[model samples]
Target: MKSSIKRYLIGRPLKSNELGEQKLNKTKALAILSSDALSSVAYGPEQILLVLVTIGAAAFWYSIPIAVGVLVLLLALILSYRQIIYAYPQGGGAYVVSKENLGVNYGLVAGGSLLVDYILTVAVSVSAGTDAITSAFPSLHSHNILIAVLFVLFITTLNLRGVTESASILAYPVYLFVIALFIMIGAGMYKIFTGQVTEALHSPIGTPVAGISLFLLLRAFASGSSALTGVEAISNAIPNFKDPAPKNAAKTLAAMGTLLAILFSGIVLLAYYYGISPNEQETVVSQIAESVFGRNAVYYFIQFTTALILVLAANTGYSAFPLLAVNLAKDKFIPRMFTIRGDRLGYSNGIITLGFASILLIIMFKGHTESLIPLYAVGVFIPFTLSQTGMILKWLREKPAGWRVKLAINATGAAISFIVSLMFFLTKFTQVWPVLVFLPLTILLFHRIKRHYEAVGDQLRIASCEAATPIEGNVMIVPVAGITHVVENSINYAKSLNADQIIAVYVAFDREEEKKFAEKWAKWQPDVRLVTLHSQYRSIIQPLTKFVDIVEHKSKEMNYRVTVVIPQFIPKEGWHNILHNQSSFLIRAFLLYRRDVIVTTVPYHLKK
Candidate 1:
């Protein structure tokens, strides 16, 4: 049954040779990687408008400037990360670059920040996707959290199927979304050219009251920067591409960047011309769609596809998070379990961890996109700054062909990103404090893990082992209940160990049972002697623990080590466990924690 579920959901386990089969081509890679950036155009503009409209209609015009600023930053990141793809073709984004150039501490910061960003990406994308749905149906408002959770589960299962499979499943929605945006832009542009436009069907509340303050303007810029969240994914995932991985990844990155810039600029421009405003229900894009195509099918098509692409955009995090965790694991900065590939060649533990984190976020925030958005970009900009900073340092140190030009571009990008990160940190400090706390703790965890691995390597060094205590004879102890086949089998096992001595002990709280067992043992005349301990109170583990303690103490005085071989019953049928005493488990648990004592489990299968 378990195998069937595994096979059905993730397919058969693949061999290392079959890994090449999982490599994604350019189109599918673009779909899987670019959806986050593309889908942001849905709420990205809305977020900008949301911040601007707080001041009033007069400030609403500032959305274009904030968006263009985000666009400039976006272009800079694209240029900066293209360099990263080629340099770190092995595919370590900010973390690898920073470690190589800036040092281990900087790498930890990049890695921790990237990880937090990936989790937030899933949370923010799922919430926004659900918001899109609730905006369309409105009736599903109460169940939006459930909807968000189910959608994340759906994407997680798809990804667990394998990267190529996930890309194939998710590719079309992103393409459709891109095509839809282009068409929407063309239609909106034609209407503008033909003078076939009107004011927004509804504008924001009242006219401009308080003139825009510098802080408010900068706040709006920070809010608009959410659009740039997923741009770094391609740089991190270059290894997932086919042969000529770096080149293919760079091409895909370029394609995604060009598409995002066009779509975002066009959408924001149309929103401005149509005079769209932030709304409590529906989105700015949804509102713009209504004004562009009225309440017709085209408008509905836009909304539906917006929701489809938005929900699926969480796939970006699903793809990137597992890989990021795997990278950290390879560095010994996280558990090795995250590095293990599943049947589908996905990082199974990492995928499950990301999914659970996303589900918790949705539950905690009640699927409110606005609340999650505030915590979004701080994670993104940290890596952007680090990656670009590392790239500048890379070009300076390597001084490759055309190095000066590369250096200047990366230096500009690094500066811009540093400023953006600082702005987000300052402006969103109250709401983003948890993220600030999480990053430092994660970095500390990385350091701790590194130290642990280093310490383990010290203890497990082969040279150290050879110079250590030499093993001699081992004393083996077996615990038995009565003179039965299970006890007979355990005694035979102990004799096979060739120990200096073998002892079988039984604890009896009742006097008659002890006498009966001793009589049976005498009659059988088993070569191994049985020592019976009478417990004044009804206790098995305490008496057994004392016996092992005595054995251990004697072994310490000499060179011999002790082994407690416990006989465990394996019930053939699941329900049979209730019929058997679990004394073996109790005895083993007590003995297992003692130092230098070897504990082994011997399973005696019960046929009935």
Candidate 2:
């Protein structure tokens, strides 16, 4: 029944051979992988204006220069990541580049930073989408949190349905957003060219709260840099492309970068010409739409598509984060569960985890895009800086053809990215300090997880057992909860092992219960010996495990092996499981770590 429900929700289980067929073509890949970068136009300019607006109208002039700076950085990243795609086509992105060229610590830092940034991408993107919705219908303002969470859940469900399907579902909305913005930009341009509207270069309005300083400009630049957050995703997800993955991925990266540059420049340019400023009540894009189309159908179309692409922007995170987790898991830096594909051939664990984390961020910040923006850029730039630096070292060490040219591009990217990372840390220190603290702690966590997996591998190494010969005798101990068919089957199974001795161990909390069980055993006349243990504290697992340890020691001294067969009943209904005691489960859990102990469960399925 559960399987049927799951199949209905995520579609039928995909076969392993169907994986190749699931790879995305360029159009679908661009829509799925570039949505985050493309949708940043909705809020990126506003983030800059939000900072500059504090100094009144005169400060708005800085938005253009800062946006240009961000564009320059964006170009450098596109060129650099194209190199990354061709060089590391296997696509671990920054983690792989940094590890191979810059060493493991740098690699882990890049991986940890990218992981945090991906979560922030979903949260900030969805929150911005919610802002777009509220801008269109102010009555929905109070429900932004609910709206944002629902968007996350919806996108997560689509992604869990697998990549190609989600891409097909999401591609049209992204194109709609692009078309709507271009129309709005063209309409605004037409007005300007036709002398219908003049440049908004009015004098300062009201008092300037803060003077324009280098710090203010840096703050604005850092804020605008959020637009570049998802550029690396194309490189990170190169393997998701169809055959000729790297070449196809590079072309897609160029296409996405081109679209992003045009849209971002158009929006920022039009906002400047229209004298748009950031406001709490409406987004800069919304204001631009209204300026061009005045709350008409076109304006609402802009808002609707903006909300969609913004929400679906999180699809980029869903695509890349799980793939990153698979890489990290393969290195044993995280749980191996992330490396396992779901029935739909997607990394279901990573997708669901990204969903929940994004929702938590939405709730914590109350679905305000502005509040989440400060935490977004720093996480992204750290990885950007590291990845570019890694590429530089790779070019230097390998010195392939055109190495100097490639080196120059990546060096420019590294320098610009590093500067941006530092500026964000310094300017947004108060809001971004937690991220500063999180990066090192996350690296430390990676180290700890790596150490644990290494230790487990060493302990379970099969090569270490080559010299150890098998013993002649064995002792089978069965922990019985009651005189039921479960115990009967467990004992019968244990007897099949041909052990020299069999003990049916029972733990009784009361003297009367022990006596009653002993008489019942005597009446059954089982050939196996019954060992009744009295637990004064009513602790069944501890007593049973301790007895097993003693038996294991005795068997070791006699050159025999010890196996504990636990009898566990299988309830026909999952909900009925709560009605039964789980002593067999407890005993197995307690004995699992004992080096010489072999614990097995014999299940007796109940029909009703």
Off by over 4 Å in 2: 198-210, 465-469
Tens-digit lDDT track for model 1 on 21-120? 9999999999998889888888877778887787766667677778888888888889889988988898868889998999989988999988878888
| Whole-structure CA lDDT of model 1 | 0.85
| Candidate 2 lDDT by residue in tens digits, 497-595 | 788999998899999999999989978746989999999998988888889989998889888888999888899999998998777777888889998
Which residue pairs overlap in candidate 2's backbone?
none
CA lDDT, every prediction?
Answer: 0.85, 0.89
TM-score of 1: 0.94
> Which regions of candidate 1 fall more than 4 Å away from where they truly are?
199-209, 524-526, 534-539, 573-586
